[model samples]
Target chain A: MGGVITGVDLLATAVFAVSGALAAAEERNDILGFILFGTITGIGGGTLRDLLLGADSVFWLYQNEYLWVCLGASLATWFLAPQFNSLQKLLLWADAVGMALFSVLGAVKAIQLGAPAVVAIGMGVMSATFGSLIRDTFLNRTPVLLAPEIYVTAAMVGAVSYTLLAFFEVVEAIALPLAILFGFGLRACAIIFDLRLPKYGDGR
Target chain B: MGGVITGVDLLATAVFAVSGALAAAEERNDILGFILFGTITGIGGGTLRDLLLGADSVFWLYQNEYLWVCLGASLATWFLAPQFNSLQKLLLWADAVGMALFSVLGAVKAIQLGAPAVVAIGMGVMSATFGSLIRDTFLNRTPVLLAPEIYVTAAMVGAVSYTLLAFFEVVEAIALPLAILFGFGLRACAIIFDLRLPKYGDGR
Candidate 1:
């Protein structure tokens, strides 16, 4: 079970790194910028979660594998930018999968640390979204969080469902996959239909 | 000495909160945005420092006073925007002082935790500048760190000097004030003379 979870985590990190590298490529940043953006986006969300939870050490400080994965993903994207142009839909699906996994895993970690359910859910959403937020912010682009999209809402759904399942004593193997699928399903629907949440003052 | 440090920390938090509120005002954000911006900016840097150091609890989590100070500062800025318009120079000076103090104090905290000198200096610079970086990023504005100004350099000077001084066994009473003044002097000069670092590709 732990092995499965770790695998998912690394895969998620790699996918996020690819997204970040693509963003840097779009900005015409140098190779150094690509690596920096990739590494930061890969590690940013988990770093924030661990810190807020007062973990003994940030996950990447002790485990170098994540860093290598990020670097590899970044270099691949940098050298193959043209190829990625045709993989946009595939990238979006991968991102959705990553977000779903991160949201559930983040909540599980927070719950293990004895955080309240609400705080755990918040951590989950943060863990799923903060890397992109950091990447966009550093690039001087408006963050996706500020957009009227169903992104964070999907993460929240995963978190809330997982927390509730845990509270009800559901086994991890069962609950984790269910929550991830639920979250990914919502995100996939949003992507397929170009769905958006209602904006503030939309009633007027 | 402890009391003095605490006072300075609170004052810096308040000053940074005011800056964040003013930024929100400039963006025409509502009152909720004002409070959220102020609170996040006030707490962001120190929280990052504490998390990086693996502190048992983040500084603001155990201390509610910081939150109140941010709230007060934000409300004051919101209601007195007109008054602040004429006090831009004063605000800049205050911000400079806050940056200088935070840089030294952040390094001191890292040193006390037995962090390496280089890491200590990095922490100091992070503590001084990250809040503003976060504020600018959330508001979709280019961060001042990228503006070729002497902003972060000033913080680095303070951190590096303080670390060097501490290594030479200088007493806190002297080292703290001297480092703060050194950093503030550099920033003040930059502000007064419109100094800038040479930009990449500027020679061409």
Candidate 2:
């Protein structure tokens, strides 16, 4: 049963790494930077998670192969970066999908750890953003999370949806798709439409 | 008994925060950035530690006063950054002292949580270096840990010393100062002499 659960986590990590590699690629970084960003984006949050849980070594530290996977993903993105440059809309689409998947997976891990709903949401955000946070930090940009952006809100929705579905014992296969759709779909729409949370005293 | 331990922890946190604020002050950043750097530098590692441990809320989150303290520290540094520039050497000396105190304190906390010696040592390193890591991240410089500098090794020795001292039934008051003195003293000496660890595969 746990094995079934862990497979989702691995998939989520791979996608998270891809997103990181893609971001670095956006800046046309060298190969070393790409892989470094990709791996950090992938492993940063989970490493913290395992360390806190006092689980045996960090998850990637034990598997070690995951490191190679991050490198491979970065290499793939390196080759793929320029190809997608012409397909501008497609790149945005890919990021949206990756965010959705990682968010749900993060919530799932938190639930597995027996955390309450609030904690599950926090973990979901961690899974989705902390790596990117590190990447932005390295790039010397104000982090996206700190910006007036729609990113974390999307992860929260995904996490909340997952938690509600689990509350009712929905089959994971069914619940996952719904959560991803809600999370990424909302995010893409927000980005595409220039939607924003209304600030206090917005003209609207 | 525990009250005294808590006092030591708070004092160390204050010292680290002061050094962090001073660093930001030296850069002459605006008020917001100073507060941001100071708070994050002071509480960042402990906040991270708490979050990773699956606690219901972050430690600082429960204590709102910590935020004000950090901000005040930042404000203080704002006035002092120029003053500190003249005493740049002394500020770094303060940082070393804070690092030494944190290494032992962090190790003690890890031990309290039943962490193994290696894990305790790692936590100590994390505690000592995490602020600098964040500072480097935000400042867009390569982190100090990546260098072959003797920074973390000094903390490691302190952590090991504290652990062994506790195992041998040494009093906290006595053991802590000894560990701190050895670590901080060594580090200070190394910095003064511009010393570094032997590079791997150096002529032995």
**Alpha-carbon local distance difference test for all models:** 0.79, 0.70
Per-model clash counts, in order, read 0, 1
Between which residue pairs do clashes occur in model 1? none
In model 1, which runs have C-alpha deviations exceeding 4 angstroms? A28-36, A75-81, A84-93, A201-204, B1-42, B52-54, B57-129, B142-204
Residues B80-174, candidate 1, lDDT per residue (tens digit)? 76555444465466567768878988998899889999999999999998888887778786666665558999999999989999999998889
Tens-place lDDT digits, model 2, residues B99-177: 7877888788777767666556656766776666676676655554444446766776787899889888799889878
Question: Docking category for candidate 1?
Answer: incorrect
Residue range A84-187, candidate 2, lDDT tens digits: 53433544555566667777877887887898988888877777776667766765556656655578888789888998998899998888879878998889
> DockQ values for all predictions?
0.15, 0.07
Q: Which ten residues in a row have the lowest lDDT in candidate 1 chain B?
A: B82-91
